[model samples]
Target: MDVNALPAGPASPGHVLEVLRRGGPMTRQELQARVGLSRATMVERLDALGRLKLLRTVGHQASSGGRRAELLAADEVGRCAVVADIGVSHVTVAVADLTATVHATRRLSTRQDPDVVLQQVLSLGRELLAETGRANDFCAVAVGVPGQVDPTSGANTAPPTMPGWSGTWVHDTLAAQLDVPVLVENDANALAFGEHLADGAPSTTLLGVKVATGIGSGVVFGRRPYRGVTGSAGEIGHVKLASHQERCSCGRTGCLAAAASGRALIRRLRSSGARTLLDVVRQVEQGRPEAVALVTEAGHLLGGVLATVVSIINPQQVRLGGPIGALPEFVAAARAAVLDAAHPVALRGLREIAPARLGDSAALVGLAGLTADAVFAPAAVNALL
Candidate 1:
């Protein structure tokens, strides 16, 4: 095996690393077969990667006749991401590996101010990184906010739920602190990506809706999230209902969130001692008359928006999350409404109206994944090499 034998261009060291990263540990012969590289080329790449301490022999495989070949892996010795999932009520910070394997995590309540929330993320992220022994690993910083973001700059846009967040340079702020690449994503979009990963990374389109304090949705087209041109692809909560003229937080009338979101529901049940979305969900589970009525109506309204979503995009899977969306009763109502209102052709490709597989941790998982991908991508690897 010789380094000079490896051709230029696509046969870069990054290519060999990517193969091992995606396909897992394999013998040099197996890797050569997979990359269709000459033994000399393969050995050169392996030697290069080995010198960089990015490739290593993990174990040995069974042999046919000669000595067994050593199974080699992309030695991701200390790589990890510091990630945050910033929700309306709380923020979850964690240190995770490229596989989204969380090593340490913490959750804390926070105020509405973007500065306060981001500060919380910064403190907790550093704390977890140190706790998990990933403090020195300079990977990416990914934060998922419950709001819209600029696709290119990763700045917060005009998010109704997060006032004063619009135009905020989330990327700059975090990048200044952590000194690494930063990714700011809508919380629902992060959840969507997390759910996509949780479902074995299916090569099918998925729509993920979160019905929390403020309703929102995320779209995943097979591999990655669909941010759309304006970075508001799945604005399900803001869908205007033709029947209702209720004022939405976005200062728009007839938006579905105005009529059906947990915020709206809590406002209606304010005098009833409903302080949180969980309070409303408890009532629904208890079968309280008002709670059941309001949630059922909300479910129908949510479904109506989803029906339009289904008709337009026709995703293979629809994952409902958050406190209200995950409720079996609410899901049933929404499912029935989608079935009734959606076009037959649209429904043909649909699977089930399922609850999110990752639940509360979805956003964190997604953020970590997004961070790891950017940091460990083939291009990134090539640049490093």
Candidate 2:
């Protein structure tokens, strides 16, 4: 976790990859400056990385003092990863390289059995790798589950929907099955990391709000996902939002998720004679008063919870993801509630509230980044070379 600990020897390939990851293709001088290494050290590192096929000189840059220096970049296709997002209803898999380009993706309906789902994930990953023609290129696998995760042990401690997943050694089980290193993380946290890396957010502190089958949030500070002491820092769903007394999946009453989650919305809609979320959207678009009222109510409830989030984190911007967050009517309602309820100081200098750019694939993209980190960790890359 210490960013300052640069690996030893000339074969510190990950340093070069890390430099290219953060700054894109850089000249040798730029690499030396960014990596804080001497010219000889930088050259050795680049050479070793190139030899390992992790980094390569892709082009040349203009120079004033001499011939243009070769520009170094990651050889993305040479070192790949498999990423999965295990949601309540489905599991999405993606194959990505070191630079995080998703080469192939697949999604499968999920079952209540965790063992069945794990097998499906492995099968889907293999299919994706075969499609990419890089079945052996992968170095690691990363999975995001909608639950509390112990990062060190990679165990799913408590998941609301996944009954038998709790206390399961997910990383170890998957690693043993796939014969690769694996990392398991909370789904929301994974989405937050994905958004932070892809959205070009300005603040080191980021809050990602996911409003799908369930409501949840993720916080990333100092360039790392922040899971609090008990790995429940951003379980905003469990926070009380209503006094009307409705039970949550966690056996708690008045939980925000019970009031505003997609499942809640769907339940309400079904009760009111609407069949699906698409039906609600269609009715809203056609100016149905009841549909508009339902979405707006959900949004208002969500915003009331987010007002507290904004008050505590004071993030530069809040990125909303999942089906509910992308709805225009829902977004407008939530924005209105936040502006009306949250403190002025928290809103000061706040940037725009927007839907996630990656859409439904955000968690998978995040898992790809995590896989890259696990595979190309300074020590791992050194061992590979």
Candidate 3:
């Protein structure tokens, strides 16, 4: 398929593609009716997309009264997007298509060096594309970093824990290496997108709290991510705690992350040889009293911070996420604290307080969905193709 041959500056093709991606296979008549394009214009757009290998005729729909209509769908095999979710201690890489279907995923221990981590992610993405026989067919790359990302520059401007990521040009570097557009977002915000879309999150207002090696929060309002002015709106980890004394990786003291993060809990339990958050979680899972108490305390601290956020955002749902969120004790304590601190009016709006449904793959899936949306949009696709 020659991407350059595809028509540019037309809205119909992208609308058709998006319709097929979201609603699955649809008949030509259905697509025409939905897009409100004339029959000839719809046919022309479909044919153009087909020529570019972006759309395919999957099968024929059952005849309603006369002839069977051809069912068209997004062609998954034609193109793919690479998604990376970079955590403080882990990284997840995947290959996905415009339909938001993930093809393959690989997880690896994260490295402190940004170069090393990026190389691993790119290598894994390339391998997945090669394995799927879609080499050079990848359109764009999206990444989720565990820090405050400047949306315009794709730089980690205020990374609280990821010291190595400071001043790093994530999007530019990825674009230069992959020869494609790159989108960078905060990991928590990505997870919020994933959780909102994947789990059928009911509310127009949603909050995702990530209590991992570091702490962070993501807010989705009206089905859109609420990224504040500098894209640092949800850096809840840096919120100060009265009793916190531990020095944070961002060279601050008394921050929420310093006192209540998984890293902080692990540090307190270091004498037990707990080097990673997983070790601490394992201990909690085994019903270790010491580990349970520490995590539960962290949860209370996190909830105290979240209560203020709840009052401000008035989100209908608060989703617990990351490794620390998996523990029932931690969630219970956090819930209790939130109930105690949240304003009465805010509590009325709040509904569910549950664990994240998508688990570790949330950020990867969110990034893939975002990349597809940006790259496959009408104007963007036309310009690229």
Candidate 4:
């Protein structure tokens, strides 16, 4: 159910918490099977978790020719987290429970100053907590920003779209302001994790591509993001293109994002009154000849880059996400492009191309999950006991 590296018993409270958090409602017998804990030991584990308000008993499961078993789930009603998804021009904030369910959401423009933006996040979080009557029950604050980050430190190593953001102490500032565990992640990685953990998700290993103001991506394998050595594993936006010659925000020419990203589209379509990424999507959906032609080219460029990625990683699917990622035409175009460019061997058994379903709030949902996992790891849970 969850990533369990700990011994499966009361001795490892993290294992028990993580299992319940990811596996959802299940009888003690079913949970015991997954964690390999004896029934007697399971009682002790559950009791400890219960005291910490980390697990709970829901309604009873239907009896199968025997006594009905009480369904137990990770308790989320007692705690909450504040999460934010930061994009080029806006931020989506939410309050989520231990189970990563959003309770309230708000959207705000991205402030030019990081401090102001983070302050806004804190203010919004406080407001949400008060409204939800969990003002003091929120455990952490997390955000997904679009840039290369030092995952552990949560500081940007470089800023492509955001000028003067490289020096901001994103994690430390949030941690200090909120006085709780603060997590910062690449927006694409957060989206990938959200997609990976989605209910009824068809693939665990996949690529999450963001094609909004900029193009970025993340690789998730077995529910863990592959962030390379310095947390820049999936910067497909900056990969050079033989066919593209435009300049990128990163000061590079011939990058995929320089040619195919939404910002690029806006530049190319300014004469046609395209303003934001939404405008670009609207144009494509309206079947504007110019927009369709441009997006198709961008889609092919994206797919061409993804083909190389697929060859190396062999992902089950390439999940297109972000604002433009919601478009069906772009999804189809990318799918066809991948099929046309990728080797047959790599394409074997690859699932059909599909638009990401998590929508615009994908990063927020993921940050909440990450918040739960990190703040309640085995060691943290055991410490609580």
RMSD of each: 2.7, 3.7, 3.1, 3.8
lDDT of 2 by residue, 1-385 (tens): 2223446654355756666766778887887887787787676777677667777678888767877878877766577788888877778888987666788888887765788888888888888889889887877788888778865555676557767777756776787877777788888898888887786653557788788788778888776788887777788888886464777888888888887877777777886676655566677788778778878888888888888888888877677887777678888888888888888998884575677778887777777776776676667776665
- The estimated TM-scores of all candidates read 0.91, 0.89, 0.89, 0.90
In the predicted model 3, the residue pairs found to clash are none
Supply candidate 4's per-residue lDDT for 376.
78
Clashing pairs in 4: 14-378
Ten-residue region with minimum lDDT total, candidate 1: 1-10
Evaluated with TM-score, which candidate comes out highest? 1
What are the per-residue Cα lDDT tens digits for candidate 3 across 176-254?
A: 8867888888989988888877756435688888888888889887766788877887889998888777798878899
Candidate 1 stretches greater than 4 Å from native = 1-9, 51-53, 56-58, 75-77
Query: What TM-score should be assigned to candidate 1?
Result: 0.91
In model 1, what is the error at residue 280, expressed in angstroms? 1.7
Q: Model 4: per-residue lDDT, tens digit, 1-385?
A: 2223335455476787778767868898888898887787777777777767787788999876888988988776667899998887888899998667789999998856867987898899899999988887889888888878875555675456676556447777777766678778888988887776673463468788888898889888866778887788998989999877898888879999888899999999999999888889889889999999899888888988988888788878677887776577778788888898887888995775677767876677778877877887877777665
Residue 316, model 1: Cα distance from true site in angstroms: 1.9
lDDT of each structure?
0.81, 0.76, 0.80, 0.80
Model 3: worst 10 consecutive residues (lDDT sum): 1-10
**Model 1 C-alpha lDDT per residue in residues 246-326, reported as the tens digit of each score:** 999989999999999999999988888898988998888888889888888898999988998999988888999888888
Stretches of model 3 off by over 4 angstroms after superposition = 1-12, 19-25, 58-64, 76-78, 133-137, 158-160, 201-203
* Candidate 1 RMSD computed on C-alpha atoms after optimal superposition onto the true structure: 2.7
Error of 2 at 101 (Å): 2.1
